[model samples]
Target: MSATASFLARRAAQKERVRILYRRALKDTLNWAVHRHLFYEDADRLRERFEANKHVEDLETVERMIADGEATYNKWRHPDPYIVPWAPGGTKFTRNPTPPSGIFIEKERKI
Candidate 1:
């Protein structure tokens, strides 16, 4: 691959990795925060952490920062992440094939 193409590919991959890391960190913060207000504060702090390094022009430095961010996120990851009550992963939403109780079906009328 040409040097420019290789650089662009590496940069794109790095951006994707950073995006994933940011999302994971945000969700992990939710696990720690009890209230929505607290979560907002924590999310802002996380954004600031990313914004602080948003202007580095060197690819090597950006890669190094990405590595550091990943390491920090891994070290601080929540042991048990919180799942939304209505989400697929949560207990309330998961169900078997059987229909829920209390629904009565009406007999179809012949025309």
Candidate 2:
């Protein structure tokens, strides 16, 4: 292969390796009982809340549920933002409105 082609191939291989590592780490973390417990608890709570209000056939209620789910997902995904040093009323750095595409590493994956 030409030099450029060889370099590109190597880069592709490295990217694949990184992706594999990311998937493995995520699987391992989620396999833990604590992770499973928290996930199921949050999921069950959300489901119960939705079911309790299922009889309310109003647009506003549906919208509220959607918003609540999104907020919960965000909080669970980024618990650190709500934790120390960035507690309530503290100077908080908002996330990028549109995160750049490609290989975005989550905080948990780094641990």
Candidate 3:
């Protein structure tokens, strides 16, 4: 690949990684904050932390920062992050799963 193409591909991958990191951090904030007020404050701080490096144009530096952030987040991540009761891996997950194909419940409506 040309140097420009390689840089563009790396930039796109970096953007995806950054997006994932931010979302993970936000959800982890919810796990740590019991009250909405505190959560908002924590979220803002997290945003500031990200914004602090928003202007760094160097790809290597951004990658290094991303790696550092991921490491720190993993170090402090909640042991049991909150999951919606009905979501996958949740307590209610698959509790009332759909019936098998051979066991149809409702009859089909004729057109």
lDDT for each of the candidates?
A: 0.87, 0.51, 0.95
RMSD (CA, Å), candidate 1 to true, equals: 4.8
Candidate 2 structure quality by residue, lDDT tens digits, 45-95 = 545654575465444554465556546544444333323334555455353
* Residues 20-108 of candidate 3: C-alpha lDDT, one tens digit per residue: 99999999999999999999999999999999888988999999999999999999999998989999989999999888889968788
Question: Which candidate gets the maximum lDDT versus the true structure?
Answer: 3
Candidate 2 clashing pairs, residues 3+ apart or interchain = none
The TM-score measured for candidate 2 stands at 0.31
Higher-ranked by TM-score: 1 or 2: 1
Candidates 1 and 2 compared: the better one by lDDT is 1
The residue-by-residue lDDT of candidate 1 on 1-111, one tens digit each, is 699998998888888988998988988999999999999999999999899988786889988998998899989988878778768878778555455688776799999
User: What TM-score should be assigned to candidate 3?
Assistant: 0.87
